[model samples]
Target chain A: AQSVTQLDSQVPVFEEAPVELRCNYSSSVSVYLFWYVQYPNQGLQLLLKYLSGSTLVKGINGFEAEFNKSQTSFHLRKPSVHISDTAEYFCAVSRLDSSYKLIFGSGTRLLVRP
Target chain B: EPEVTQTPSHQVTQMGQEVILRCVPISNHLYFYWYRQILGQKVEFLVSFYNNEISEKSEIFDDQFSVERPDGSNFTLKIRSTKLEDSAMYFCGGRQSSYEQYFGPGTRLTVT
Candidate 1:
């Protein structure tokens, strides 16, 4: 089984400021990591993922995440945020050798204020 | 680019009523899934489907819940008797070989 923890329930940042949303996971086996963003009343959009190779993964919308094996963490970061970036961010994980069902974190609400 | 689509953007039903939410996954995708999120809550996986049958399901997929690929283009989730707790935004997704899943806009079910 895989479990994810997103520490902050809400993050308020001024527009153009850098932001980081913390995420941690616990899994006995190897796993795939992902971050998704959901706008109000909309579906989740893939932000980034850590499947293999480089631990640092870049995604759409100028977002990125680093998969730290020792820390069991995958934190999402952006140098500058836009007001449109306000959304609910979810961190998810799936066991590599087991079922592909994704276990998601409680989510972090990003409020990019102008 | 192709993407997943869901119908009946919003549904209102009385308690104990049966409701079916529909979805059309991306073409060429083999895996389908259903997930739900109540207001202000995290998304929870309900079930996953492959090869015309269920591949995996969460504990929340109780006897009241079922999934089907009635046709090549349509995937549906049926709730036999909706409870107040069943009210949530139900999302349908599909994966084409990769681990990444594409999601639909979702159906907001309101059980009154």
Candidate 2:
């Protein structure tokens, strides 16, 4: 079984300011990590994922995340944010198997103020 | 690019009534899943279907909840009797392989 924890329930930042959203997970085995974004009245959109090869993963909208294995963390970051970046972000994990069922964290609401 | 599509963007139903949420997955995808998010809550997986059968399901997928792939392209989630707690946004997803899953816009189901 896999579980994800997103410590911050909400994060507020000014436009053009850098931001980071923390996420951690617990699993007995290797797992796949993913980040998803949900805009107001919209569906979940895949932001990025970490399967293997790289510790730092870059995603759409100038966002990126780094997978820290020793710390069991996969934190999302952006050099600068825009008001349009205001949305809910989720961290999810799936065990390294064929099931592909994802366990998600309680999302972090990003409020990018203009 | 092909994407997963869901029908009836919003649905209102009386308590104890039945409702069916529909989804059309991306072509050539073999796996499908259903998840729900209550207001201000995390998205929770309900079930996963593959090879025309349920491959995995969570405890939340009770007897009242059932899923079927009626046609080759359509996937449906049927609630035998809805309750106030069942009100939430339901999302459908399809995966082509083992990687990223494409999600539909979702159907907001409101139980009165």
Query: lDDT winner among the candidates?
Result: 2
| Residue-by-residue lDDT tens digits, candidate 2, A1-114 | 788999999999999999999999999999999999999999999999999998999999999999999999999999999999999999999887647888999999999998
Kindly report the docking quality category of candidate 1: high
> Which CAPRI tier for candidate 2?
high
Candidate 2, DockQ score (0 to 1): 0.82
Where is model 2 more than 4 Å wrong at Cα? none
Note the DockQ of each predicted structure. 0.81, 0.82
Q: Give the alpha carbon lDDT tens digit for every residue of A78-103 in model 1.
A: 99999999999999997877557788
Output the lDDT of residue B14, model 2. 100
Pairs with steric clashes in candidate 1: none
- Stretches of candidate 1 off by over 4 Å are none
| Candidate 2 C-alpha error for residue A23, in Å | 0.4
